[model samples]
Target chain A: DQQVKQNSPSLSVQEGRISILNCDYTNSMFDYFLWYKKYPAEGPTFLISISSIKDKNEDGRFTVFLNKSAKHLSLHIVPSQPGDSAVYFCAASLSYNTDKLIFGTGTRLQVFP
Target chain B: DVKVTQSSRYLVKRTGEKVFLECVQDMDHENMFWYRQDPGLGLRLIYFSYDVKMKEKGDIPEGYSVSREKKERFSLILESASTNQTSMYLCASSSVTRVSYEQYFGPGTRLTVT
Candidate 1:
């Protein structure tokens, strides 16, 4: 069973516009959520993360919002740039210190000019 | 910066052959993980090692075994490879400091079983 799911397989947004990627998880025990960005043929790098204690976390142009009651989270990138185009994976862990993470299928975000 | 390196970027092996995928991390991390990525399956963990000579099975560890003789190295062994085992293998390592629990990943190894 997939504990984490990214319903959208792909997303496209024009440059300078906002891009939103959504993720849902079936396990409510997950307390820490992270987003990673992966480029072609490269390893995924950490983008942003949110703890269950907080509803939102932001890093520069990226912001991650979590809704614990709904078991859903979203990543928002304002003024999206072409460099932001990549596969984004949302991962969840039972706690902030847990080593095991359940990852979503991923959403490919394309930021165009 | 944390650096994770895999042995090969792409590998081709025949069925029933023994395949070994090696990974090394330079950050002296306490955790190392091996995962396989498929088209729609995302990344499925095969095994993880928390310390030297210590290992634990992950969600999908049936066809694989792992060894961590040293703190910097982790090895994944495929006893007898099969066609279904072909996929992109990734290695990751994270420190025990619990700083957002971020994992540093390798470039990945694309293994093809023929």
Candidate 2:
């Protein structure tokens, strides 16, 4: 069984709009969640993260919201830019030393100029 | 700055050949991971190392083995390459933390077993 899941395979939005990507998990043990962005050949880069203790975490243009009761989390990128076009992955870990992270299938987000 | 370096950006090997993929991280993080990314399966962890000489199998470890000889290096080995093993391999490293788990990845190595 998949502990983490991203149901959407792809998403498209206009530049300067808000782009929301959803992720769901079945394991309640997960306490830390992270979002990663990947370009074609380069590796994934950490975009933003949210801890289970908090409902939300925000960066400059990116925000991650966690709803523990719903077993759901989402990443929102405001004022989406053409440079934001890439694959996004959501991952979850139970705790600190839980060096292992369960990742979703990833969502390809395209920003149209 | 944290940097993870992979041995190769592209590797081509024949079936039944022994294959090795090496990764090095300069961040001195306690955790290092190896994952394979495919079209539909996303990123699947094959192995990870928490410290020197300490390793653990990830979700999918079959047909693969890993070694962490030194603190900054992690290696993934395929005893005998198989066609099915062809995929993009990514290596990542992260500091041990409770609330935040951020991993730094290397430029992936695309491996093809012919």
Candidate 3:
């Protein structure tokens, strides 16, 4: 069973525009969600995350919105930059004390100049 | 600074040959994980260890085994490699922080079975 799913395989956006990535989950027990960004050869780096209690969380140009009723969440980047182009993975876990994280397939974001 | 390093960034092996992928993490983390990444399948966990000598199977553990003899080292063993097993393998380590499991991953091992 895929507890976490990123339906979009790829996305394209213009520089200085907004870029949004979506993710959904089947497991309701997952209370925490995270976003990871990766370059071509490097391992994924942590981006931002949100808890179930909050509807949205923002950090710099990155923001995460969680809709518990729909079991869906999304990442938004305002004024997307060319440097932001990379693969983004959505992950979920019951809690941070546990190491088992369910990751999505990943969405490749291309910020076209 | 904490670091996770894999023994190989790229490896090639013949079918049916035994293979070993080694991962080491500094920082005395209590958790270590092994996962494989395919084109569209995403990151699938093969196994994870919470402590030395203790391991638990993840979503995809078939045809594989793991060893955690030391807290900082975790090894994944493929008894009989197959072509279908060709993929990018990743290792990660995490500390059980207050309410989150933020993992740090290695560069990854791209294995090819010929």
The DockQ values of the predictions, listed in order, are 0.80, 0.82, 0.76
- Model 1: native contacts recovered, as a fraction: 0.64
Tell me the tens digit of each residue's lDDT in model 1 across A5-112. Answer: 999999999999999999999997899999999887788898999989999999999999999999999999998999999999999998643988889999999999
Q: Which ten residues in a row have the lowest lDDT in candidate 2 chain B?
A: B94-103
Off by over 4 Å in 3: A95-97
Query: What fnat does each of the candidate structures reach?
Result: 0.64, 0.77, 0.61
Error in Å for residue B13 of model 3:
0.6
Worst 10 residues of 3 chain B by lDDT: B95-104
lDDT of 2 by residue, B8-67 (tens): 999999999999999999988889999999987899999998989999888889999999
Candidate 3, lDDT over the whole model: 0.92
Clashing pairs in 3: A96-B100, A96-B101
Interface DockQ of candidate 3? 0.76
Best by DockQ: 2
Candidate 2 error regions (>4 Å): B97-99
